[model samples]
Target chain A: MTADDPVRDSLERFIGKPMGEGAVAPEEVNLPMIRHWVDALDDRNPIYLDEAVAAETRMGGVVAPPAMLQTWTMPSPVIAGIAERGGAPTAMKSENVVTALDAAGYVGTLATNSELEFERYLRVGDRLKTTSALESISPRKRTGLGLGYFVTWITTYWAGEDEIVGRQLFRIFKFDPSTMGGAA
Target chain B: MSAGTIHVGDELPVFELPVTSTVIVAGAIASRDFMPAHHDSEYARGQGAPDMFMNILTTNGYVSKFITDWAGPEAMVKKIAIRLGGPAIPGQPLRFSGQVIAAEDKNDERVFEVTIRAANDLGDHATGTVVVSLPLEPSS
Candidate 1:
């Protein structure tokens, strides 16, 4: 897709736009959620579960995994319901770009890459907030999946007021999966 | 795990994850990723995916868990950068492995950079780097 493409034009309007007004986590960093995550992954880390072990360590207390940064700020189901019910404005999200592309015949999407940088580990009780901005939208390119464009966004996770705990550079491809048959 | 003992070529411990459909769906929900492609097998197949695949959020959690499992709980992750190449499909076990590429002494702590990869039969599912800081041992 090029600048001349209507779908591309719609997506271009989102470039540099912040995702949502500012996403504040509905819950604070806590052990229950962290436990759920570790359990799901079957992670047997003593510091994450055993308080005594954590006390002996330098961290002095249990801390949420840095990778959980995005989890804390994920859009809650209630919030999604509100948006679906038209009770709230559509938050600035990359999904909007996908919806626009889907309407233009690009119905398939897949995450291609992600880069995360964490400044520090998040401790229990800490709250998180996130803001994302569309970084770039690539021109149409051929790939194993099909003809598509790559959309990139930068999301920063914040703790408390101003401290940036982590940042994720995420990219996904919007494409026509049917074209895969012709790809090598 | 002492940071001082790590070397540039040292290999991180390998981990195997037995992926299951239930786990895939549960992980998606836990991560608040309600994407149909991650839970509904039919929806995934419709999208040309073999079956419901692991979402990036779940992949990120697994990657971090693998690193911390080797680095020990005391070690704090400073960064992780990953690129997804293949779909982590259910019924295929995902194997995770890594090697220490660099280690440095920063202030009173030791930091190690590990190059890591997660793979399945299809090929590398994800590859990335993680920077972790190991606490300094108390002076005796």
Candidate 2:
């Protein structure tokens, strides 16, 4: 239950620090991705694509699905050898807490929570950028999967000269699979 | 489904999604999440997942749709907070259900908190609260 290792001591330094540099959206909010999401999920919300219907509603125009907030800034992937890199969209940077945890033997990652808050709906042509900060890291504890630490981070999405658009607080459990002895 | 009509404890219509590789892969690609466990079954098995599963963005999308489908287009989602569990794998249909847990009047809008759960045979894939608002009608 105690996380008194040197690695744990090092991790505490990351709390409240920037995870990395801010990332700009590869593409501005556009119709294509919205349409794709609508068809893929079978979501028929007229406000998402039907401009005429949306114009009559309170929105006054088509707005991207609020949940698509995170998609705008996803790093473009390198298709080849992605699985070998453990499904990371790009090569891992050595300085972040995630890489540090993996290096310290907490090799399994499980997403446990997501809290998304939108300040305003997004319109087409709105470009987004995200800045993330490490919020907290819990001490080692026993979980259903094994022994792990709970890592939480907050990402803020911004658009058009410092106007806040939304925010997401995401949490993951990074555990050591080899520690699954009796729990397994 | 106007601001005047919504009440605490009101249930939203149930929605059932037929999970499939197509669903999983389409959502993953649309969200630009290229993680292999969401698109490659063999890779997922190697990672110890039952199969390629639904990604979190897709789950949030479905959760958003479920609320808007019932609350109508005028509703705006303010927040969606959920705790994830179990995998939403192919061949199992994920059933979506929800209820208005609290409702209050804010300036120019009526805010409502909805508790939702998306479950399949494996177990509850996601469970949490979504906060949404609808414009209040102007006084005549």
Candidate 3:
């Protein structure tokens, strides 16, 4: 398919009615769980590893940070080189999105920022579910690469009770990387 | 805007979610936010961010839903404004805080004027104000 394909066609079948959500079981909030995440981010914050300091804080323990949801839900690297699984290659974080674009039948694109909201906490061991939907899909004035963009509403739930923990609204653009600043 | 609906000091829903590298990496990859600070810690530090910073936009979405998610599905989000401060480092507990400061009825819709904030063990990370429309129809 050429770079000039319609962006609406560049999405995966998952884009239909396209409401998505996931539920994860609750787990105990522990130090090890907290430490690994901090270590992964290379954070030296004493709260993650230092119990003494943790007791002094309002949390009463080495509780995870407020925006710690990212530490818990990341993609596995097991499927490293499936072009069809993800399009942009291993190096590009935008790979699967790029892949989704290809599945949608469009090429060369970028993910644009819009807005987000933080609502709850996810301590270690807190099982949760995340759900998302196609909030809106409107045509932008044709840019250099594709015709328009698609935006979605992604939300995560903590444990079983809370209605929401966080929300993310993002947009993806389908275009020709070669024609623009282009290419990772 | 009516002050009775939401007092000036009422807090919005700002979540104190965990900040972890796994979610950082996964979320970064999922959103295709390829910034190094997100994927590589050593490189991220070298670049001057405090470990992996949660993508700001994603942070906003997460917190926004903390409120609207409960408010309902038909509630239309009119607008949201955010200011990012410290890097949302992994490990730190992030508190997503939002409060309704004002409210008004326009064209048959109850428009909530709210202020949102995200704080960590250290201090505030992000803050913003939002205007959202609640469903005219009552919840089931």
Candidate 4:
């Protein structure tokens, strides 16, 4: 859409706002979940499993896989509800951003890409908090699925107030479900 | 496995996962991603996906697994970036393979960067790069 379009104008307002609550993991950064992740993916890294092997490394302790950045802060029903009801969960008001797009006839949603940079590996007991903001919302564009807009968000994973453990730039496409007859 | 030993162009062993509807749904739940497109094949079909497919989180997890498995536990994955090329359609097994595209020394530590790809018969499911930190020598 154009800059003057109400949808774009309203969405633009949320560009620098916090996306959601400081999502807390249901559990801590521990071995069980890390083991489960490795099992699911069949990863046999000794550093993640074998204590002796991990001890030999400089990490001196088992560290969670870096790719678990988003998994550590998954959205729960409560968060979804907050978004649906237009509640301000946090600074990057994703719910408002998404709701605005939905009202504009972009209902179908799909994650397109994710790029993560880690400053350090996540170790056990290292709790995380993420702060994200709407980076940009693209005008409607045609693709294999259908016509939709690309929404990008930048998220920073923090271990504490000043320790930035990682940052992820994620993108998603919101389209109309009616355009479902084409190739994926 | 230490960073100093891994040379550029070293190919990592292939890891395979036989895709299935159950696997797809289970992965979706594990990652707490319930977008109907991942669990409901009918809904997914209605939304234009061939059937239930793997989510990006699962793909990212697999990518991490592939890298760490090859780099050994000692290798610390400092970064992993991925782009989805296609869906991991059910019944099509995914094969993951990678090559060390770059290696260098950083602060007396070895840093190895790999370009990896996961694919099925339909096409590539994901392609990405992983950066890991390793000691100069394997610690026996």
Best by DockQ: 2
Error of 4 at A148 (Å): 2.3
Cα displacement (Å) at residue A59, model 3 = 2.5
TM-score to true structure, per model: 0.87, 0.97, 0.46, 0.85
Task: Estimate the overall C-alpha local distance difference test score of candidate 1.
Answer: 0.80
Candidate 4 collision pairs:
A17-A91, A17-A92, A18-A91, A18-A92, A18-A93, A19-A92, A47-B73
Question: What is the Å distance of residue B17 in model 3 from its true position?
Answer: 24
Candidate 2 local lDDT, A66-166, one digit each (tens): 99999999998999999999998888664888888998999999999999999999999999999999999987777877887899999999997799999
DockQ of each: 0.50, 0.72, 0.06, 0.48
- By TM-score, the candidates rank as 2, 1, 4, 3
Give the top-scoring candidate (TM-score): 2
lDDT of 3 by residue, B45-90 (tens): 6544568677653564465456554344334455565655666788
DockQ value for model 3: 0.06
Q: What TM-score does chain A of each model score against the native chain A?
A: 0.81, 0.95, 0.63, 0.80
In model 3, what lDDT does residue A24 have? Answer: 45
lDDT head-to-head 1 vs 4, winner: 1
Show where candidate 1 strays beyond 4 Å: A1-10, A78-96, A178-184, B138-140
* Global lDDT scores for all candidate models: 0.80, 0.93, 0.54, 0.77
**In model 3, which regions exceed 4 Å deviation?**
A1-30, A40-46, A80-84, A87-101, A114-116, A144-146, A161-163, A176-184, B1-140
lDDT of 3 at A44: 51
